[model samples]
Target: MSGKSSLKDDIYAAVLDDIIEGIYKQNEIITEKQLIAKYGVSKSPIRDALIELCKEGVLISHPRYGYEVVRINEREIRDVVDFRILIETGCFRVAAPTFTKEDIEELKNFTLNECWWNGKDELPALKHWENNMRFHLKLISYSGNDYCYRMVENSTGLLTRAYAQRFWDQRDNRAWNIDIEGHLCIIRCMEEGRFDLAEQELKKDIASFLDIICPNYARAVDL
Candidate 1:
């Protein structure tokens, strides 16, 4: 990437980080002037970053007012969760038998608390979410299908941002409740050459996301 392009990406990530970290709340207006001042950049890169965010559905553009952070609803969250189940479980079924001992070991590492925060100083919730995403993406990658990997990556990104936006104040509580033990069960099933059981555990892991987001809501899949 060119220096200018790299700068734009950096600006984009910084703004998105603010949004996911709850520095920018849902439906809040963000202006180019504010970002330019914060990043100490010219208007060109700032506008480019805002446009990219708008295209990703993270922000909506207003003619003269500025950009507004978009709020994710329960229905949309369910749709993303359902899509995750479809893709993640399907990929695991194809990829589980192909996993080697090394892959299994790496997956097990994600279950460790320190693996998510070895050197990073990010918020606990963001670190936890990053670990969850890495685990799932790494597992799906064994499918040897780039298309499937990209799909899971994008959907998981949406879910992560949604979780932060929805429960910013309760992030720590929700992050701690994630099903890390479920990941262990999946890994064990794979280690035992029980791909069938592993696939089932994968489905449950994806559905468990709903419990974290909406404690009282009924999941579409019966655990």
Candidate 2:
């Protein structure tokens, strides 16, 4: 990558991390001057990063004021959740039937691997989320469709940011443990060639976030 592009990407990630970590609250104004001073970079990469964030709907650009962090509404959250279900389970249906013994074993390792954590009870929310993404992406990869994989990847990333913003202070290890079980159940259904059942389990896994999104939006299975 070109040095300018690399700097832009790095600044983009740094700004995104700040947003996710609550350093930049919703609707907070961020100016290029502030980012330039903070990162000790020039205006070009700062503008590039801010422009990229604006394109992603993560920020709103004001002509003279600066960029404002976009506040995600409940409706937008539900839309993202539904989009994830459509791509992930849809891809799972196409992929599950083609999973080999090796594929199944590798998936099992995602949840069952001890190296990724000290123990389930002691797992960090960040690490648990990583495993969750790994399992879902791995299953989707078997579909052999690059576009579907990218869709799931991007949707999951948005959800991850939302998740951190909502549940950062409410770390419940038990809930994450339940999600791991959900992952295992989907894998079991895939192993048995029960594509329909596997899809249901995958939907439930994706819908687990509904608990955080809203009380009205319960699990997908209930809907």
Candidate 3:
């Protein structure tokens, strides 16, 4: 990449991290001057970063004004959660039939170790979240379906950013704690080759999460 393109990517990554870390709240106006000073870079990189964030649905741009953070919408959160359920459950269904004991142990160990970092008022929570996602990604990595895996991974960054914002505001621990148990349960079911049980637990897990993140959205599974 050219120097300009590299600079743009760096700026994009920094601004995106700030948004995900709650440095910028939803629907808040972001002035170019402020970003210019914060990043201490030329206007070119700042502009490129804002444009990319807009494409990611993390920012909204106006003709006369600069970009503003995207507002959190219950409907949008619901839609994303629904999509997650479809893709993630399908991944587990396909992978569980052949999942091995080693796979289960790896997932279990990753989650249990990561839980230690949670509940400590960490500023960015990205490390904890990344590790948590790794467990699920590993479970699906052997599904022999690259498209499904890639789609889920790509969608997760945006969805997780949205959820993290809400999670920080509400300070709800129930959903977070459930996430830990849910992963463990899924691993156990897969280890036992209980595909049906694994699918059932996966649905419930996503449903509980949807309720937390988008309470007004349609349920993922009929309760």
Candidate 4:
């Protein structure tokens, strides 16, 4: 890649992470100068990165000054959880019966407490969000539905923003171990071939997360 392209990619990755980590609040303005300094790149890279984010709806463009971070409100939050609930609950219905013990174990591999923290033992919201995504995607993929996995994966941008917006400090204050426990419950139910219980646990876990992140977000996920 050209230097400019390389810089743009780096800036994009860094800024995207910040956006999804909720480090930059909604409607916040970020200037190229700030990013140029932050990423130690030229103005061109920063401009390109902002433009790219705007394309992804992660940022809104401003003429010459800077870009504005879009707000991910409770409605958006509700949509994400409800989406997960709908897909995941259905996934368990189909995937649970076919799941072997090995499948459950595979899903469990990522839910370890070690997955929640960074090398410094700090619980970063972005890292945890990634882990959460992996868990959900792994479960869906194991369900043997190609379309389902792709559908959920396509929501990564929006989902990451929603997660970062609320979960930035949640892991710091709350115990992510509880989240692992919830996943374990779902896995156990699936392994036991109790699809009903697995579905219930999956819904409850999504609802619980919604309650924590955005209580104003409608908690009901209609089947």
Q: What's each prediction's clash count?
A: 0, 0, 0, 0
Q: What is the C-alpha lDDT of each candidate?
A: 0.80, 0.78, 0.73, 0.73
How displaced is residue 215 in candidate 3, in Å?
2.1
Q: How does model 4 fare in lDDT?
A: 0.73
Residue-wise C-alpha lDDT for candidate 3, range 124-181, written one tens digit per residue = 4555466556766666676878898898788778777877677667455544433466
What TM-score, over all chains together, does every model reach?
0.85, 0.85, 0.83, 0.79
Ranking by lDDT: 1, 2, 4, 3
Ranking 1 against 2 by lDDT, winner: 1
Compose the digit string of candidate 2's lDDT tens values, residues 15-120.
Answer: 9989887788777899999999998988999999999999998999998999998877666778888888988878777776678989888878765773254566
TM-score of 1: 0.85
Number of the top-ranking candidate, with lDDT as the measure:
1
Can you write out model 4's per-residue Cα lDDT over 86-189, one digit (the tens) per residue?
98788768866677778777677656643443442454546655666777777788778899888889776786676666555444454432256677788787
Candidate 2 weakest ten by summed lDDT = 169-178
Which residue pairs collide in model 1, if any?
none
- Candidate 3 Cα deviation (angstroms), residue 194: 1.4
Model 4: pairs clashing at backbone N, Cα or C within 3 Å: none
- Report clash pairs, candidate 2: none
lDDT of 3: 0.73
What is the Cα-based TM-score of model 2? 0.85
C-alpha displacement of 13 in model 1, angstroms?
Answer: 1.0
> What tens-digit string does per-residue lDDT give for candidate 1 at 132-207?
7887887888889999999988897688888888667544454443546777799899889888988888898888
Error of 4 at 168 (Å): 5.2
